[model samples]
Target: MLLGVVLTVLCLPFLWWYFFLQKFKSLSAIPGPRPLPLIGNALDVGDTPTALFNNCAKLLDQYGDIFKVFIANECKVFIANADFLEEIMTSNVHITKSNGYYLLKPFLNFGLLTSSGSKWKRRRKLITPTFHFKILDQFLDIFNASSDILVKKLFNEVGKESTDVCPYIHLFSLDVICETAMGVKISSQEGKNSEYVNSLIHYFDIFIVRFFSAWRRFDFLFKFAPEYPIQEKYLETLQKFSTSVIKKRRLEKSQEVVETTSDLGIKRRVALLDLLLESDDLTNDDIKEEINTFMFEGHDTTASGVTFALLALAENPEVQQKVYDEVLAVVGDETYVSMQHLQDTKYLEMVIKEVQRKYGAVPFVERQLEMDATIRGVHFPRGTTLNLYLYGVHHNEKYFPEPEKFDPDRFLPHRQSERHNYAFVPFSAGPRNCVGQKFAMLAMKVIIIKILKTFKIIQVPDHKPQLGMAAVLKSYNGVRIRLIRRDTD
Candidate 1:
């Protein structure tokens, strides 16, 4: 009886796969790497992070526009065409995030990034007002202050050998997010290591590892894995830190008595957290999740965007000069970058757009089908996951010719007007696009302008870093550039 029971258990998975999972077989018609019975293309897609990233690029090169890849019999259809992306992203039924985002749930909980259905709708509505032009304009003081610290920090590195600018840029972005989103100061620019910051880095590392390993996806297996203890420790630290900040802010909100006036004579001192605190429908957990969400999204993504912009500029001196000229022409010798200056820096804006096109911070956005839908004459049944490859789309030669060249003129108004609306989606398109995009753009513009006004970025010869995928797009080595003080010139 015992031998019979063990054999039955062993046969169950194969029986289920044959009787239930294989019946649909809609994806078999889609072209992709051949799959084995149970582990479909799992071995083909490498298990290590670097190999996985390379495998994705290789697959895109081999399979044009759209194709399928199975992760343990689960069909993930990768769509690289602009029209298909528009159809998928704009649909109301496909608004739910994919199962891959489940890895982020431990950190983000039911926050906007991971939430779905009515919960997402409600959270989005509640947080929308916090990014209004007026509210974001109020954060300019924080941006300006942080930019000053960043400039000073970079100034110390000037005339040295080419330095990896990623860490400094990361810290600057971190300080801006903490101050603007949480109304707290961590002084990350002071060059002291932050326990909270270190924990966040480790947390993301484990998240990447688990995301690539199918076995780690199961809670039972992950709980006993070697990395689980480290992940748990960092998660606890992050949660503890965020909870303490939220509680303190809540208490201060109850007794706060001060208000400051802006240059426009408007009384203001608001944060994203303050907006959440105003809503009666939200719980403490709700507020904490949102804070953590913004903290992660706002800082890391911007750092990638800005760091890549610098690298691109360093490689193209002529483009860098044009941006420097534009900044001087617009904001010349100003102590701080103003909203008016941000609006007027047209050439700089083009440069930023080009950077995002070449190196979008978040390489892909994913969605899962809640109902069967046909897109572009192709039918995708329910339970199918669509991986919208933003990086692939951005680099497609048909959309942007000579796609690898770093040319800012590609984003000129007339050129941009002629392209499809969805062709260049650095911030993505459709209803569920990034809410903090304007804030992110403004921060990037301010920081880039500050750096350009003070120094000329020069590239290290023949040393460009190869790209790698992580929670955000990153260089396997760091983004290194030499800063030559403009005062000397």
Candidate 2:
């Protein structure tokens, strides 16, 4: 019986390879670090987020723009070239996300970020209008309110030796997303503690761990792994939180008679949840899926962007001064940042673009080809997984000369015109691109501008971001900086 089990296990890889041999050989022309039998290039990718990030960059340098890696039994082709990126990103047929996204199903289910085909199309159509200019304009109040709270909260840390700003940013972002998406604020910023936030961080840690684990990729094998139970625990916690919020919001909607008035007789501002609830086509479950999706994507991605932007500003005082001067010129002494103010800060916008180019929140995205296609004379069979390495693409020397330098001028009109349109896709591209990208950019500008207005961010001695790429790009070592009150400074 033991011999039989061992033999079956050994044969599994051979069986998998036997079926896909032709498809595998077709990709042999693509350059990559050589793969070993069965496990393939699994070990080459690294175990931790930091190692994985660094190793990926090294692989890109060696393999050039496009490369192949066999992570266990799965083959993933990493594409970083702008021209090739344009072909794949613009395709309507290759919109299906890779299998790795399945790990998020426990938390986000098949919501907008993970869903595909007709379901994704319908949901995208239904939710696209929620981010319209008029609707987003209504969110400025929420942004200003949240920024005020964040500013007040940071006042307590102004004189501290070095503050880790990531946590504070996370809380502030959670507060904003909760209000904008759900119509209720949990005051995560005020409370200064959140299990949901902690759970989210832990969830990403587990996901990254599993995402690179050869054994954990299989359900049957992962059942025995230690992360399984822990993942289930957090999944239950996350689900309960989302479920309770959706139920409460639905009850409130059910009890309301007037569309513009609340039970307290106050005028009600529409939230994403309110719009979703008004839809006749969706059930409470469908709404929960979307709510969870938005709550995670809307807040976390924005927080990561703002955190990195601050880090960039801290390290580059000249650039920071430029931004501060720009902000002063645009909206001097104004507590409320208007839509026009956000649009007019072209220099600050350029800085944000540079930050994204260097440290995009979602560093990489994955997709699966729906049908066979050829690019640059290389044939990709149907169902091949493609890793759109946005970080690699943004940092490629061909797109931006001296890519490591923090120069916002690269985004200058004439310079930007020199690069491929798909060269810097921080929010991704094509039909399946992020729908809330504009919303995210506006929110980030609001918080960052608000902070810079009050404080001069100084970098901690020798502090640098130890990069990591989980679901989002974050620094494992924390973003540490000192803040001096601008008035006192």
Candidate 3:
């Protein structure tokens, strides 16, 4: 009898919260898998990052644009359509980033990518001008130089009858990002045999591995998760690397030394490291966080995006030839592509946009709620999960027409993209959109230009590319393609 009373007391809050409270709410309109006892959608949200939320389209078709899933008793709302997305993203409602992003706090602190409210606002302002068009114009020199180094490396391998371009691109991007972000030129194109690239990659590998570990999922469980050790080491590496670079640069500048050879140019006019160091209101930790964010952001996504685009081009040689012919006609035997040439590469630009539509390197963007809010006629209680389902929205046939078809013509002239606000958000939308987007695009343009000018991107025989979810979706096997140097030198 006494035991029965105690048990009843213990169960009452959960029983009331799960049964009486949720029953009154009109969740019937939202479609999702049935919730489990106490756990809710815990089973539905996969443990591994590889297991994507299943058949979201089928569910959206059945339930509607706005649907609910309960993970570990937390109610999550997934938005699919433009209007719903606009409400959340636009000023229609003051919806903030979801608490789900708190998980990334261990890996990335309150970096611009994962901060909220006024802090995010202030940080965004300081950093916004850093990536302005004029600043990025300064970065084009590094972009062109790095692209040349990468093309030369690939040409050397293709010269030796190589049968893949993916690994080569990844290596190339890493080197460029290293040079751009840290202002340290490490030749990742030369393999891990080099000390600097090896140290950087060593830390980078662990950082990515830490992002998707099981500890991240059940973050509320452990006293201190395994990511703590991982992050400590990551920060250690970052600190050591940044400190050394800063010290070396100040020393070099003090001595008034000019450093470099013919290809690398005599000086670096501007770089990511310089931006962070120059930006006021950013403390040492803030600088470090920004540096870390830029380092990861600078390389992987751009590399993966380039790989996907190159693969798409390889699969459709007609399109590749079109791009090649456009380069020939427009640039007309220019040894190096200039910024003006990049602007004229309209077909190339269209192709990149189409690639982003078809295979965006990142498939989802997450945000937390500021307070209790309403979304799509539903009152979302504070701390509910809201996701802008990137893949679902991107592939929706209503927005992209024949969504699967690879046609750059879809983004041609006279077609105002204003018709669809949230239809195709490869880099997301609004003010919080990617700060490094311009930087990434410029890098890809230079690399693609130089590579295409020298070698034609070709497919390889054992072209089985499989992707596993890391910080972003990336090739586990690397993109396998052979770059056949044009004119066959």
Candidates' lDDT values, in order?
0.85, 0.88, 0.69
Ranking by TM-score: 2, 1, 3
* Candidate 3 lDDT, 211-238, residue by residue in tens: 4444544556433765456556655665
- Which pairs clash inside model 2? none
* Residue-pair clashes, model 1: 0
User: How big is the RMSD of model 2?
Assistant: 2.3
In model 2, where is the ten-residue run with the lowest total lDDT?
255-264
Model 1 RMSD, rounded to 1 decimal: 2.7
Clashing pairs in 3: 41-70, 96-368, 97-367, 97-368, 98-367, 98-368, 164-481, 165-481
lDDT of 3 at 145: 78
Q: Model 2 over residues 1-489: C-alpha lDDT tens digits?
A: 999999999998788766765666889888898777767787888877888899899999998988989876578898889888888888887889999898888788999999999999999999998889998999999999999999999999988999999999998999889888887777888874367767766887788888877678677888899989998887787788778877877777787743567658878778898889889999888998998899878887899999999999999999999999999999999999999999999999999999999999988999988888787688888878999999999999989889889999999999899889999999999998888899998999999999999999999998888998867898999999999999998
State the lDDT of candidate 1 residue by residue for 1-489, as single tens digits: 999999999999878667544644766667788866677778777776566667877888898778788777577887778999888778777898888788988899879888889889888888888899998898888898998899999988988888999999999999999888887778988955488888887788888888888889777899989999998889999999889878877776677631444335666478788888888998789899999999888998999999999999999999998998889899998888899999999998999999999988988888888888888887788888898888888888778998889988998889999887888998878878899999999999999998988899999887778787756888878999999999997
**lDDT for model 2:** 0.88
